[model samples]
Target: MRTTILLLLAVLPLTLMAQRWHITGFGGLSNYQGDLQEKRITTNQANGAFGLGVQYDLNPKLSLRGGLVYGKLSGDDKKNTDSFLVARNLNFTSPLLEGHILAEYRFFDLDNYRFTPYVFAGLGIFGFEPYTFDTTGQKYYLQPLGTEGQGLSIYPDRKPYKRVQVALPFGAGLKFRLNEMVTLGYEIGWRKTFTDYIDDVSTTYVDPAALLAERGPKAVELSYRGGELKDGNPNYPADGTVRGGSKVKDWYYFQGITVGVRLGSGSGPFSGGGGGKRSRQTDCPRNVF
Candidate 1:
């Protein structure tokens, strides 16, 4: 009986320490939805996304997760088979970095099953720099140009948009416990943003004359890029013409596999002779989730 008690005490600390925290690493494809994306999912245009995160299990059913992710989003009118979109001749790419905090809910008690489905929701902010290449292959950042009459004397109603925007991320995933310390997960998350200018295309075209005077001639050239239309003698859109939809906002997505592992600390949950019931449930359960 004394030997069994000693063995239980030794095992208890290890189990609690293992359950406290986990580190996650993930990588996968990313895509965006906006005026440029006629289709919701464009695999050919998918960009790379990667992230590193940490998780703290609050209970058998819930956890708190925090992470930083980097994703690249891009869109081009040229990729569209739609006749009208092809004539638009505009394209932009934005690389984003985001930090988020989320709550994760497991549908089944993790201790009861090796596999579980889960859902997560979080708030985050991301920074993006939208850029496009000119005919000479020189890259230009679009925000400075105020493409839609922003930051211009002629258009006081239009304000310069922010480079960093807020977003809500929500998603679901399925995870499989590979071992006592490691788990694998497949997740797909959508970032619903508050801003529509992630691609630097929104609202109506600004007057070229005004943009040239305020920003530069290059600004005017990039503000309306239909000049390279496949059909000869392309007619550029006039000022006040629709450049992008104003009513709807842009969105981006991430879908990938995550590998997680628990790395314990000396003063963990099960340290200093914690509750025996909690420690026992870590190894043995009377009922399943």
Candidate 2:
């Protein structure tokens, strides 16, 4: 009995030192630049973002984490010069408040390497706003005008628009345990947004002149001159002969990648200590976005 008591005492400190729950926080710089559909227009911008969250180890092989993230995404405008000559030079920015829940599985746990690799996927929701400027030095909230003969319209009365959309986030990462309580790691992830109008442009139409007036023309011309604009014909061919009938569609998509770090405690059920053990370890859950 005395020998058993001594053994329990020796194991108590190690058990207490084991990590069961961990809190992680990190900040980093990110940038996104890409085209929408076949539009030749390009968007490029850089910004900083951060995340804070907590993780609970259900066992040595599996864990769950939940956290909040804040960030911004901006891009260049698309230029439309078909039947409707709407030359839009716009930029988009969003203050995203997101929450994510992820399950992680450590695949490679070696003593000398002390590195664990994992994959995770989650969902997020965010707020978005897009701003536009024309060649005539006008600034407006609405998309560029799509009118015939006349130039871009300037609509100042249009109320600011905001929308919430679901986001799919998934990626793989590597974590090197610097110590029992501290982990240094890097992650690469992709976020896919559900909204197709992140650029603030969609299947909407406005008078070019009115839009230009609201948004000063800085050499930008929003004019419609195609068969579709003239007689409401959607079957208008792209022949140079067709005149005075074109409309602009405000549709776009958002995609980006992020890198960050995580920190947490070392006490866990499967840290080879006294906590309950898990039967049949499993890999990380797949992305649900």
Candidate 3:
């Protein structure tokens, strides 16, 4: 009984230490796909992104991770070659902040291989507020302006959309073990969002008179920008004119390199202990050698 108690005490700390955890830092470029950007993925306006996270190894092939990432997204109608888009004449930029929890699966064992390709899928919540600068360089946020008649008494169906929304994150990456203490990798992840308003242009246009009366002049000015463009449509569309595609939701993605450091010195069950030495027996020591 005494020996068993002593063994339990001695092994508990080592067992806890053997649980592998990593602190990770990531830096990369982020881009978006929305009404303004017709392409599925483009680097035309990619912006800087970075994140910090913690990960735990569930076994040789699985890991669970959680982290926060911040990035910027921007799009412009003038940059598009499509004449219809050019005539629409809209542009926006927003800062994206996301918090996510993901499960990762690796193709190779970390203990035996120096490199591996991995995939991850998980859930996240993100926040964003789209804004644009007028001809005079005055910046205006678009949501509260109710560009599509959101929050208006006349449009009962066009409810105000929240700035924060949920997203599904999934992607693949390659990882290289720098050493037992450090690791390096590159990952590309896409966030599938539930809302189409990330770019602040969804659904049809509202009546300019009503928008002006309710949200004021700035709202009307920013809500429909085609008139501001040279050779663009001088007249704003009538109420219910299609402003954006509401059927397809917006998507954002991040691609970058990651660096991780192991949290403790104790080796996991399969990793084997240091110095190629056999593990000491767990039974209580008979006496000091």
Candidate 4:
């Protein structure tokens, strides 16, 4: 970590000199998709995300950037009519705290327009929290089976799943100089995570009876509200089961598009330097008539 900080610091001056240091922030929308209830569900979800950080110009051709970003992804799921007799709805929301270190290379730099186009790729770390809400308006926490408990939503007493995973962040964007001291840009990127439980859905289906037997009535009701009971007993196989939990290895991904402006010193590749007739004059010098 110290080495990483040092490396960033070492490149700071170069970025500053090249007019590369920028304070950027952005907000955008994203959707969550993948295995839910044994079916692939893609919902039109809305997301908002923003970041604040500085970029270092390694040179006119390359640069590095890092920032702290807070983002959310949410959507709703409907039960599959064919496989399950119960009618239910699942809603989920995940807020992530992410940090990204990216390397950017510019493809075109138009001196006349003061605009640059670039592409970037990097790694990030994210904190994930996933929650489930049932039709009854009650919320139940879920955990991966066998990690600390026996079944899904079984331990109502336990906390939600919190994990730290590595992420791959890649995207492209364009920057336009508003002036020497200001710049504006827009970016679109995708974050690929290592965890499969972003939506609180995975590969295996749960036996409703077995889950209820372990979790009791409160949990069963909370997780399966608004659904018809084809089976009378929680352990009875005849009643439809909750699909998901068989380990198929899944990951959560979110896409972001942002537009923001930066404020900084106007000295760099586009500033044209500080030398002119004004340099020879003191404060408010007047021309002799």
Q: What TM-score does structure 1 among the candidates reach? A: 0.86
Backbone clash count for every predicted candidate, in the order shown: 0, 44, 0, 8
Give lDDT tens digits, candidate 1, residues 1-289. 9999999999876677575889999899888998888676667688999999999888767889999999899999889887666677889999989999999999865544677999999899999999999999999999998988889998999999998989999999999876556789899999999998988888998778888889998888887777777663356577888888989999998998988887753323532224423354444532343
Ranking 1 against 2 by TM-score, winner = 1
Model 4, residue 171: distance off in Å is 1.1
Candidate 2 minimal-lDDT segment of 10 residues: 280-289
Sort the predicted structures by lDDT, highest score first.
3, 1, 4, 2
TM-scores, all models, native as reference: 0.86, 0.55, 0.90, 0.67
Query: Which candidate do you rate higher for TM-score, 2 or 3?
Result: 3
lDDT: the better of candidates 1 and 4: 1
In candidate 3, which residue ranges exceed 4 Å CA deviation? 1-19, 266-269, 274-289
- Top candidate on lDDT is 3
> What digit string (tens of lDDT, one per residue) describes model 4 on residues 140-217?
554432222244465444343456778888878887756545667777676666666676654333455665566665
- The 0-to-1 C-alpha lDDT of every candidate, in the order given, reads 0.82, 0.48, 0.86, 0.56
Model 2 C-alpha lDDT per residue in residues 40-159, reported as the tens digit of each score: 223335467777788766666576777877766555433333323322233445455667787777675411236767777776666555444444556644333222212222434443
lDDT value, residue 142 of candidate 3: 86
- Backbone clashes in model 4: 8
**Per-residue lDDT value at 1 in model 2:** 100
